[model samples]
Target: MRIRIVLTFILLATGLLGCTEQRATVAVPQTAQASFSWFEYQGSDPVFAEPLAPDQYQNPVVAGFFPDPSITRRGDDYYMAVSSFTYTPGVPILHSRDLVNWQLIGHALTRESQLDVSGARGSRGIFAPTLRYHDGVFYMITTLIDNGGNFFVTATDPAGPWSDPVWLPELDGIDPDIFFDDDGRVYIAHNGPPPGEPLYEGHRAIWLWEFDPKLQKVKASSGRIIVNGGVDLSKQPIWIEAPHLYKINDWYYLLCAEGGTADEHSEVVFRTRSLDQAFEPYEGNPILTQRDLDPSRPDPITTAGHADIVQTPDGEWWAIFLATRAYDQRFYNTGREAFLLPVSWQDDWPTILPAGETVTYRPVRPAGLDNHPVLEPLTGNFTWRDEFNQPALNFHWSLLRDFARQWLKIANDKLQVQPQAGRLSSLEPVSFIGRRQQHMHYRASTALTLSASGLSAGITALQSEAYHYYLGVRRSSNGTTIFLEQADGEGVDIIASEQLSVSGDTEIGLAIEGDKDKVRFFYQLDGETWLPLGGSFDGKLLSTQVAGGFVGTMLGLHSRLEKQDI
Candidate 1:
């Protein structure tokens, strides 16, 4: 085996193409190669995997980078949608009969006409979405920040050919939620600027508008500021956003997320008897927050807010909120995850969690629901393996801001991903596909066959363009070498590399493990023992706190041209 420095660039590998996908239009080197025989991801978090009573369930009903969750119910069936940011196939739609075991149905935004995030940053595309079902129609209202403003898509079925976006140019704000009153009234609520001069930085208000379902537009001259500066103005609340409205009995309830989406993040509520009346703040505001707890608490869950509440057919109320579980306090790489909590009603007021109370990691299952068969485990310690045998990609896989073209092919039960010039950091969408890093103590591995003239192709743990870790293998004229590459705000750097004695095309295995703050990278050849390619590195670099993005870490196969400049 000849030893040599490995200078290789990694590209983003995507999921297998559908049967009708056209040929890829992107140019690639003739010798480029990235084919995976199998990919597997497993998680073993004791806190989540602990034995639970049949009446109990995991807190994070939907895990990983799925954030700003909004749920809607259609009789006994429940459907959910979450923010996908810059990834194509934007809002993932999940379905559940019991609301505890959810299954991926499809995406709400699949076509370029529905979601165009081109030239947007990794964390800058799709914002909070409010999914609602009324009168046999499903509506998903959301904000597409940079390219477009607010919009709504409609579909008869949530697992959809969701209609092209009906852009809401008149609306101004994020997390646009639609509410239908029993009195044949339609309203829209969102987070945006106050009526006049701002009181302070992050001083925002909740605005309400009467929307016309028939005309598909906001009623002219019907917009008004409903809540200013959150629950209180003199108290000086910051970043009051993600407003969700509900009406229980005669009182109209308004829920909003406050205090910027960090440790200070929280959920608050207000109530009024009618829309014409002013909403009064709850006497005990900030129904949910984790900032007051000690930072030294073990396996702390922080940034708990952004809730959307729904009622079951049995008259039970449950709230689905976004929160972060950090191995170390305030630092989490898995991003904001969807948590489940029962909403307790107190004297005609709905409360999720009391102030200063820690969010529970495990909660009793919703009572009066039948024992729905487990389709698959969304929470707890579970292993998911994909053999590339299916004709179409699994809904779990994600594609970053790219059109659904033929960037990948599945033949002989192997996923073959062509190489691309653009690295993951480029403003242009790279040809990459990855799954959200769901667990802090999980391992992701894949087995791929590298060509004799091997191009760069391997595992990547990506948070954003500026912050990502790439474990790639390439074959130079000297020999084959595996390297661990990382990029931060500063730039990309090769941290570790090892030359292999393999002379020809070989099946190589790559793996990455994230244990709290520490992350390790590894690679192996011909089913041999996995050898460490890099030392245990700080995993916080891949977290939202460090990366400064709303997205979580993605762990899966990513590839790039072997000749691209660092």
Candidate 2:
């Protein structure tokens, strides 16, 4: 009788406890997409961390062509601006909360009324802009490469309806930086050829001047030579530009990026007690460098300079500098990306990476973190497939010239592209389908089924107007054949021609592989085994230095004919 009563009591208690445990263990599903994976060299299929994810690191967190980054923190918000370098809408403004994530809000220059960059080269647009917020107004100062010298623009909102450019008629130099002192005085620092000479022939010096905020100009009499490399060649005697000013405690610090922004680039820091005095070189100059990283591996981080310092909300200090990561050890993909380094105050000066090394692995997050923001992913996993219902082109696509509406349309879940009545060289032809190179060794394949009445439809690797590499099928006099062409700086011509028996409404796929020096081409018909078309092509034909445009070399799609039918 006692055992039977105990069994009923035990059964009821066990059922109640099981329900409680189930409720406690269950978790709500996350609404957002999957978190980005971090870059681990040891992982078998390593994935890159999100652009600015909360759980993982956000790298090059700022997107696009943000070269020569200048950042500042006001309260909880961070504002940054970068060199636009010949792009039409210039000096893009970005906002961020944590250093790892950023978003582009607006452009400082919209109308070309004040400055025109119609014919500017790739790296010759707006140079080194300094962003500052003071007295309820935000100020951005930069230099226009081809037009007026240094200019300033102001706005109340970080995402701006910015005021027109205030040209500083007296300031004459490039890579201009503005420093607003604690006492309400504004100073402009720049580099130029000595008073009556040119900068391209030889090296130059740094100049400082007091700027008038109301007049929107530099007081002509205020110009003075702060540092002259001609006086001491031991200062490296090379290009010393992008001077940034920061006041730490009682001393004023002037830091600059040295070298020609190539493999030999470095970061140099100097300081003084007064703005008028010559900056004393730091005993441990070049606090950060990658010159000695590896003897076998090409230095991964080249052009590591143009640093901007910001203090976090928790009182931690950090420096954001520009560095380039080469994808193929020859072709640069991360074109001047922003890298963050923690700074510590020692001996009344700022010390970064006290180990005197560059960080390749992601660092640990800062402490006292309750809430972290999620970062957007930069890589779009979509490939050559087109389900063309969207009204606009994808982010991966861009035209060589201004895009036209008539040449392309989307309907019936297919992208309909009409062949223009001109050659591929004509600007009006609108032969455009291009994507940025994400990896050097990866193969790019597209299945293009042409419905046009013409004989040419295929893919091409475009360098510029005079230099390109293309492998495509066309209806020649002999039959349909896949032709390979390479254009040096001289002219475009057939390199290796092979005749094929392929007919109408067929699928074409092309693959390009190799480093920047040598590119190989391959093709497959109807998803068959790929046949090697061309090997070890000269990569000089696809270089931005030789191409003369604001865009990098792009892999493009085209439909063309040698002569149009009457």
Candidate 3:
């Protein structure tokens, strides 16, 4: 199984679609008597894979919304970063020592000027990134599809005040990687048009240019097409992207992802003795793949490509790549998650997950590596509770994108979201902060106080830009009420609701229970008593199978107003 916590988000304006929704009034106290502790759901089956034997561990070294991982080692310390898409903190930087454990360090792109993805669609902001350390400086080169095309940011420290992006308008495509040769020469490679197009279907090539660090641009006269149409000219592979250059011994090896980012995704390699000579394709192409595996294997992981290789201090090599864990056969809502696999090199060519073998949950730990501190569960199961008592939310929490303006704050032991006029499904940022759903069977709840009429705050199971379910409390001049709403292609539908006699300072509890098959919504006035608010809804509606995107489900607190605008 693949574990991912993702935040490729897109927001919409509230109430703009003019869909009629049901409303109800309820009575609740203004203050919560006690805070409820986060509890795991008790089910017949285990929520997580059993922990590995003391000597062994799990794949998905980093879980949740962490994908397209590019890793670099700096003196026994390993630093990795992943794609964040349209999320405000574009590239999430993580630090690890053992490769099995990782911690969030900081983002490489935090400023709107550095990387502005405001109003960009989900999964359209940032693509793959290549993180490398040369001398004392750290360099991250990536493509911001929504802003400028290709750019690189530099920081002396991995936990960084990353420099503003140095855009390379000369680099014509995405998935860019920088390679520094031993002879004091720097090169940049990317998936771009061959000198001319229109050769055949799926016609794409890997282009390279000599990069001058002092000038922060590509040397125009040094451009060359390295590999055209992938490994086999007769096969015609599509989307030969995500290029990485590695020089071993005397050969320069070119590694890239071919096919697409779907089930057919695979990694292919090529090598050459000289920089400008014709590169020879590996006789055994597609160094990594899962497309040929049996479809009926239980809890299969498909789309296993777009991989990056890293070498440890002990001479052990591992490949970090993106894959999906489908729930109930072909439905996966977790997006593409980072998976770890050991790499074995024989005669200068590397292979992943041996012939006739698929990705496994418990891979033997690399030899001679000391284990790092385990801060979170590797099985993607845990109890998380936030009372909003801190000055700022934890780094683990994420917002959809940088809002047009600030609309929320943390104060008075609660997260106060501005009452903007809109629905929870609005395109513009209303008021939302969320975390990814790491398990199929889990419980999520929140306690809140609503002070004004026409304001609502509660929990949501957000799948994408146009699909989600909301369990919220709406206040009106008459009384307060709790309601359950679902947003589908037909627009918003109020499935069920209940009225309560609530006034100022009243507190109410909302909860969501999700299983592999369906989800149930509930609310409570007394902390111990939960009243079901709606019938079980089809859980597959929120699955990527039905939602169709690169984002997983985000569960979080959201508030909307009926007559206010931000």
Scored by TM-score, the top model is 1
How do these models rank on lDDT, best leading?
1, 3, 2
Best by lDDT: 1
lDDT of 3 by residue, 1-566 (tens): 11111222221332233333333323323332122222122222252457667777666666555777888889888888888777767788888888877878778987778987755656578889999999899999999985799999999998889999999999888899999999989999999985576377667889999999888889999988898878886787888989999888798988899998777888888999999798898888788888888878887878788888888878888888887777666676556778888888888888876655788767788777898875644345567667677886666666776634356666677676655444445445556667767666778888877766656777888876567887877666656777777876445677777888766666788888887668999887876899888678978878776767667777877776642210
Clashes of each: 8, 4, 31
Cα lDDT tens digits, model 1, 409-486, are 777898888776556666554768898888889999998876535357889999987788888887656667788877
What are the runs in model 2 whose C-alpha is more than 4 Å off? 1-65, 103-115, 135-137, 155-164, 195-202, 230-232, 327-334, 354-356, 366-375, 379-438, 441-485, 494-566
**Candidate 1 accuracy as TM-score:** 0.93
Q: What lDDT would candidate 2 get against the real structure?
A: 0.60
Candidate 3 Cα errors over 4 Å, as ranges: 1-47, 198-202, 377-379, 403-405, 422-426, 563-566
Candidate 1 colliding pairs, count:
8
Model 1 ranges with Cα > 4 A deviation: 1-31, 452-454, 564-566
lDDT of 2 at 472: 61
Q: How close is candidate 3 to the true structure, as a TM-score?
A: 0.89
For candidate 2, the 10 contiguous residues with the lowest summed lDDT are: 36-45
Which 10-residue window of candidate 3 scores lowest in summed lDDT?
1-10
